[model samples]
Target: MEDRKKDHIDLAFSSRLNGDMVDNRFDYEPMLGIHGKKDLSFEFADKIMQLPIWVSSMTGGTKRAGTINKNLAQACGEFGLGMGLGSCRILLDSPEYFDDFNVRPIMGDDVPLFANIGICQLEQMLQNRSEGELDELVDKLQADGLAIHINPMQEAFQPEGDVLKTPPIELLKKYLEKTDLKIIVKEVGQGFGKESLRQLLALPLEAIEFGALGGTNFSLVELNRSEAVAAEVYNPFIHIGHTADNMTHTINQLVDKMGYKIKVNNVIISGGISSLLDGYYLTEISKMPAIFGMGSAFLRHSMGSYDKLQSYVEKLANGLQLANNFLRVKL
Candidate 1:
């Protein structure tokens, strides 16, 4: 036992942390709050969640997608986090893969679970003037809202992509006018810019997810899938879009400018967030009620085992508890 303890100490001594660990806003003051007493729970989209980490939309419409979705739902149920399912457009025309998207039983009746669809799919529904199937999709899945993912670059790069006749903002505005379901506007991988963020903030949305640049650039995913010539032509666009930090600042500025009149009151900081610290910082910096999310990270964990996913979430919950007591965002 003594030898094992010495080996563990040696291993810890071999690893070194950098000076970048410093958060500019805080002092090394005496810790006062009891860790267990700190409230990590919050209300989002009419659902109360114990943590603010969202399992951002990633997979559906695949053979193994059921396992992944069910694993994620089970984790959210255990940890009290939120989930947004990947594109449910497949369910609109057919129920062939309905089980792939059905996860409410695993997730239980609570937690913010929303179905997702591309803007182009919604555009088609607008043209047909029938959102009956869409409403049914929500009702069947028992989702809290619909997340309309705006991904023009991804579509343009995809081989069988649909062209948009109108801009996403216009489509969203029109859809809101005629429908009553809750809406959440999100980017695919390229996060929103100042102007686009401004417009989305004006709407009464459940939340705005910063599908910022950095992690899983969907344009790059589609570009790689495209023919070599097409991939070369569209490669530059994969570098576009803002970061989560930039979007957080933009949301704060917009809220400041609009004061109390801004309709959107929540933001989901996702995309490039790779660690719990990034999640903590972005969530704290945003002026609105904010949650941090990850796709590839959660996807990697969920695709393996429920135990693996739960272990990851357990670390996150512990880190968040420590962060709430020790860290503060820079002004």
Candidate 2:
């Protein structure tokens, strides 16, 4: 069982694809009325933000992951966006062994910070702890909310992936009952469809991050580790999911027509958002508090010296400001 799980995780992480290239078909437009300085101070429940973006969860299970999380948190603190720590399962599983990992330094007092754990992990958490323990962890971390990531595609491609015995929506409801912290249901990469959204909405969720298909292809990730039959079977499906644009349209239409009012605390469109223009377009079209959480880009940038990291942040800021300016015109 353990070997199978290891194989699954290895396959999921092995995908040698960059998020920026896969979702590059989008065109940039200068939309008027998008800029009008409409106070961008949004919130994840009570957490306030100068901008509507957050650095989405990237990594933190291993030492290398911890370094990435540290840099990411620092970037989030510098830029006024929220930061999400990657899966804390390893840390939670063996706190002493991973005691070196820390999230406080990368986070800011005012900016939002999110704790991440998979849906399967949540189900296990529900069995072990009382409600208070969950609440305490939120309070301890000073996190504004908890992100329950849904990544069945990665799992399905994983050689030893956990057999998802039950629907995650049910587990999500269980978590909702136990914590006061807002619950955010997010996809890792594969975008959510209407049926999936419907199931998610049935649970008490604060927001949704449509980690759409156009960005990071989990199938490609699996393909890197897969051999023989599995690789061939999965490789063809790399482009099978919805793009960020499609997801935005679908979710907006659902709210507009279906009257399926899920708090929609925010709509994070984070598949192929690489440039300032990309971020702007997503915010304009989705019309929700959006985020351009560039996991792979950030990872690559961080591989260099601190100066390079700083430069990357500068570029991101410039892009955001440019987008803001472009959107302010009254079309």
Candidate 3:
């Protein structure tokens, strides 16, 4: 105790924070709440998640992907969280990389696991009348549903990117009419505009994951891979997307205006969600039932070892519980 007090005294001068460093979004009511036993459990994707955290899709079909996915699945299983696999495009015609994404056994049957595919790939399947492969892909992985990531900007920036022959909404409508498979639609870095969100809310989607701006921008990713001139010319386009807060406000207004017209009831407030506070704030403001997702954050820890990933997930759960117990969003 003496040593601890000495250390505290030594660090006290350096630990002083400025008034501008305060977080004003939440009202910290320490007196009204105790850090007693708290339950952060919530139902999402038809599964009860102990922590409202989703491991957003990051990578697959790479050398390190197997180890990373194994670590991630084990973390989710241990923490009782949900996960979305990186693009399962490689699994469409080949089973060679199937083991990398086959994480259901590791995560168990209790948590939600969703397979991901790009909207461009879906369009191609529809064009060739090979959409049946999608269902087969989902069944092979034992996934509860599928997440269709829409990345028009990323595709446009890629030199060898697939052409989006049809609008994503039209493709989604066509696919929904034929399949009973549960579906989620998300963006890649750049989030949806107001009109896009309106059309999506009208669909029978299981959920909408806002892969909003401020995270890993795939458009910027593709741009970096391009020649210098192309990258320079297209740099401005990378900043044209919406943030999590912007999307949340837009959805809330739409809900108020549309009433029963809003078909999708759940949302995964992803992108730019750097901390538990960001997740808590966005989810609190959203009118729909919401959880938060992280891609790069989980991928970074999962690349090392299962023990590292497990520790990180435990910290995430504890931090979120603390936020829920003490912080309230200021209206």
Best by TM-score: 3
Question: What ranking of all candidate models by TM-score puts the best one first?
Answer: 3, 1, 2
Question: Where does model 1 exceed 4 Å of error?
Answer: 1-5, 18-30, 33-37
Ranked by lDDT, the better of candidates 2 and 3 is 3
Model 1, span 1-331: residue lDDT tens: 9999988899996777779975675544346555564778879888999898899997888878989999999999998999999999888777989999999998997798999989999999999988667788899999998999999989999998999989999999989887677888889889999999888888888889899998888888888899999987778888888998888888888889988678885888988999988888878777799999899999999887789999988998988887787665566
Error of 2 at 15 (Å): 35
TM-score: the better of candidates 1 and 3:
3
Question: What digit string (tens of lDDT, one per residue) describes model 3 on residues 1-331?
Answer: 9999999999999999999999999998887777665888878768888888889997788779988998999988889999999999988767899999999999999999999999999999998999998899999899999999999999999989998989999999999998988899999898999999999999999899999999999999999999999999999999999999999999999999998999896899999989878998888888998989998889888888688888888888878877878888898
Which ten-residue region of model 3 has the weakest summed lDDT?
31-40
Candidate 2 residue lDDT tens string, 130-212: 54555655666667777888877677887766556668877776767767777778887777888887666556666787778
As for candidate 3, its clashing pairs are none
Query: What stretches of model 3 exceed 4 Å from their correct place?
Result: none
lDDT of 2: 0.68
Q: Pick the winner on TM-score between candidates 1 and 2.
A: 1
